[model samples]
Target chain A: MARVVGSRLGVGLALSVVAVVIVALLSSSTRLAVALGLGVAVLGVGATLVSLPAVRRDHPVVTRALISVVVVDLAVVLTFRVSATSNSNVAIGAAMAIVLLGLSFLTGSSGQISLGNGAFMGVGAFTVGIWADHHATTPLVVVLVLATVAGALVGLVLGLPATRLRGPYLAGMTLAFAVAFGAILNVFSSWTGGDSGLQLPSAVVAPHWLASYFGPGASTLTTSSAWLADISIVVTGVALFLMANLFASRTGRAMRLVRDNDVAAELVGVSLPRARVVAFTVSAAYAALGGALWTLVNNAVSPSTYGFVLSITILSLVVIGGIGTIPGAIIGGIIYAFSAGAISWLTAHLGLNPQGNVASQLDGIIFGGLLVLTIVFAPMGIAGLVRHGWRRWRRG
Target chain B: MDSFLTSRNVSDLLGGVTSGVIYALVALSLVLIWRSTRMLNFAQGAMAVFATYIGFAILAPSTNYWVSMAVAILAGLVLGGVTERVLVRPLYGKPEINPIVAMVGLLLVLESIAAAIWSTSSRALATPFSIVDWQLNHKPVALSPFALYEIITSLVVMAIVAGLFQYTKLGLQLRAAALAPEVSRLLGVRVGRMLTVGWMLSTAVGAVTAVLVASNFFTGLTPSGMDGVFAFGFIAAAIGGLDSPVGAMVSGLALGVVFQFVGDYVNSNAIILVALAMLIVSLMVRPNGIFTRSAQRRV
Candidate 1:
């Protein structure tokens, strides 16, 4: 126990030192917000390291949350100091990670297939879009909350009947919803903003106090977008932390038991329907939260963006990034973010037309191949593969 | 007023029949796979779209519709065989959901390949037969030539499939292999080859649907042309009992007419939601399927 605590304390101190190096590299002219962020992260790390021996064994989840908070705090400040484009890129990645987390929980733990999560996300996005159309003055937090509630309601309604379904039947319903999303959007064009999509009346503006802090006398970070990135990171961080705890909770265990063997789960008195419904509803809420955050980064929502292809892509990425794991979701999101850039770059160099179908579909091909390979070779995904390799190497 | 009602009602009915055959054709393909593997081929739509792309390529150079269709079916046979052998073969005896997910991956890969070769732009395929609606007393009341072509083709294919399953030795072996692989193997049924042939025949059926639908029912030969059709067919397959091909045909046609009425009377956009509702309600009410008599669960 002493040795293990010593190692964790050493790792925590090393991370804090790296955090200081990153803080120093950003220069003194950077935001006081950055310094304040650094101070908080370091203090958190210090506090957690001190509490490691006490809480490490008995309250591992608390230990994990503390570590995650420190990581997120440092990341928020680092992303804030980056260029506007990279900041926006990070923001998009963060939002997608939240969505992937939802998928990982539903698919990885509960073992339900959902092809309509894109549409569910659309439910959240359009909540923001349609709500803003009618009530432009609604506070962002209230709108986000409403978006989540809207998604959960939709999930509950859909999930209740779906709980009785298995495999193809469940997938069939979700696939139908996904394929029909565009048609549904077109029906209420006035509210959904129709084909053209809805633009926020204003960009997601950081508040004045935040602007003053983030502006930092024009040290290269655009005030609002960077602040938006910061907000996105925080939201993503909270999602990560919450999902992690859920995975370690009794409900998560029940869902997993239901996934592995329904008969066994039933024998244990776990209500199969309730477990399935809870997984479905919770997954939908996470997707909605991710979608609501997307509005912050993109400032617009379109029907075309939330179609069957997007849904498939989301699933494929989850599988490729390692389904059913929190780290897998984040890894998948990062892979998606980077691969988009890489594909565009490769297509440009290869003389492929950007608007051409082949160039557009390159990512699909890569992800699809990876998905098939992952399922066959490493059912747990890239994270599983890495984890396996790490364990083998450690033994060697 | 009487003429107006008859004209609209008859036209909608004819239209429903036309689309219903298309759905039945797709449902037939799905039922074929499900009977053998107990797996839903989510890539069935994408595979159909691919065969259509190949058919379009053939028809583009020469305006011979039959020749293009023959070649397309041949293409589907080869593609399906390859898919079953390479991609799907590894997934057997695994979790039930793996096949579905892998097929989704195949769907993406196949659609992407189709797009890479033919592009995603929509284009109309030329129908050898005319599309002018047959009329009675100066009011359109029946099927057009192309619509008739679609129904006749589907009927012929359905009949041929039924005959093959009932009368042929190969079909008997295929059935035995799917029904009892261990016993069939002991009896020298060549279970592996049967599965490959099963997929080949199934995709050929889907190919026929794709080629025929390109005449009147399908929008155009786009990469996503058959995805919507796939969903409706999935509903039909579920209603028909995934194990029954005959059930697929009847339920598919019935669903087509009912789905048409919903689109015609209600908002057309509501069609998908209606499809989803039908699927969910049916799955909940009769998980074994409406057309099925037995409610046996396979472990």
Candidate 2:
């Protein structure tokens, strides 16, 4: 178990270092490259030392999780500070990570498959989009809260029937929900801004007060891109922390019991319906939060963005990240971010015309191939592979 | 003049039934596969679209609709058999939901591959029959020669399938294998082979539906051309009961007429909304499905 934890940390640290290197190489600024390179060197040394045979095995799961969160947060911030063009992509990936974490609880713990969280995310994005459009001065925090509430409310309503449905039936209902949500957005074009979608107000950086307290030079960090990245990291860290705690709770155990065997769970006095509903509601709220963050990052919300494709992609992420695990979700997010970035870089450097649709087609192919390959060969995902390798090494 | 006899109403009714036949074809395919394997082939639409594209490619060179349709059906049979053998065989005895995820993955991969090969733009396939509406009492109605052909083809296919299931030895073996795989295996029936055959037949049906519907119902051969049709077929099959082919046919046609009426009287965008509403309401009222005699807990 100790070796597993160490190897997990080592894997994460190596991924972060690779991400930093990629950002540094992609950026045009020499200063950014030097800073990122130095950070990578230090992180590399630290990770190596920790993974050494002499390292102590006294760290608890909570401590390991905290260390992961801090390392990932720093990596995200550094990546964002260096690359402006890819900031939105990184932020979206982080938001998706948070949503995947939420889904991991439901799918991993409760054994429910939801393809409708995209709609919940859409609701969250539109909540923020509508608010920012109508009242541009409203605080981001308030908007996020409202979005989360709206998501949870919708989730509760959706979860009612979901409690009875299982497997394909549940999938069918959620698929209908996603389809209906998209149609509703189009029908109520006056509010959702129709198929063209709604443009959000420019995302503001740190409020004037916060920036003033940080002194004059800190204002540079308040750029919309930088601020969005910072917000994404903070939200993701908090969500991961909460998710970890939830997974360790009694309710979480009940969820797992319900997932594994409903008959057995019922015999033990677990309220199956209530557990399923709570899981659905919480996951939906998380999806909404992710959606809200997405809007903040992109400064827009479109109905097309939260369609069946997005829903399937989220499912694929959870599966590819290792279902039901927080660390898996983070790794999934990082992989998503890097692959998207790499695809864009390849397209740009190859001088492929974006308008010709080659880039998007290639992106689709990669994601699809990855999804199929992962499901077939590595059902336990990247994290599972690492654990397997660690066990083998220890045995030797 | 009676309001019910209005030309517009009659036209809408005709159009609805016409499109409903197409939906029935796809629904029948879905029902066939579900009954045999107890798995929803989410990639059915993509597979059909792929076969249709292949047919379209043949059409461009040969300009022969019959030849192209035959080619498409054959391609669908092979593709379906290969997929079942390669991808789905390993997934036997896994959790019910795992197959759903795998099918979604297959859907994505197939759709992406189709897009890469054919390009994303919609391309029209030349139909043998005229797409123009036929004359009715000196007025143009919604019924076209092509529409009539599609309706006839669907009915014929369904009849053929029904006949096979009722009268053929192979069909009996298939049914027995689906119902009791272990028992069938003990009885010397090739259960695995039957499952593959089921996929092939179902996929061929889907391909036929795609070919029939593509020219008129959709713009043309695009990666997402069959998505809406797939959704409607799913709903129709669900309403009819996933196990009942006859039910799928009836519900699909009924849904077609209802959606046509909605499109005519209400907003066109509300069609999917109405379909979803129908699905939810049906599931709530009769979880076992409207046609099934036995209520099986699918979850």
DockQ top scorer: 1
Model 2 chain A is weakest, by summed lDDT over 10 consecutive residues, at A53-62
lDDT of 2 by residue, B126-209 (tens): 889998887655667778899998888889999988888889999899899989999999999999999999999999999998
The chain A TM-scores for the candidates, taken one by one, are 0.87, 0.82
Q: What is the C-alpha local distance difference test score of candidate 1?
A: 0.82
Tens digits of per-residue lDDT for model 1, A114-167? 988888889899889888778887777788889989999988888887677887
Residue B111 lDDT (model 1): 87
Clashing residue pairs, backbone N/CA/C < 3 A, model 2: none
RMSD of 1: 3.3
Candidate 1, B168: how far from true, in Å? 1.5
Best by lDDT: 1
Instruction: State the weakest 10-residue window (summed lDDT) of model 2 chain B.
Output: B1-10
The segments of candidate 1 whose C-alpha lies over 4 angstroms from its true place after superposition are A1-56, A212-222, B1-6, B58-60
Evaluate all candidate structures by whole-model CA lDDT and list the values in order: 0.82, 0.80
Question: Which number leads on TM-score?
Answer: 1
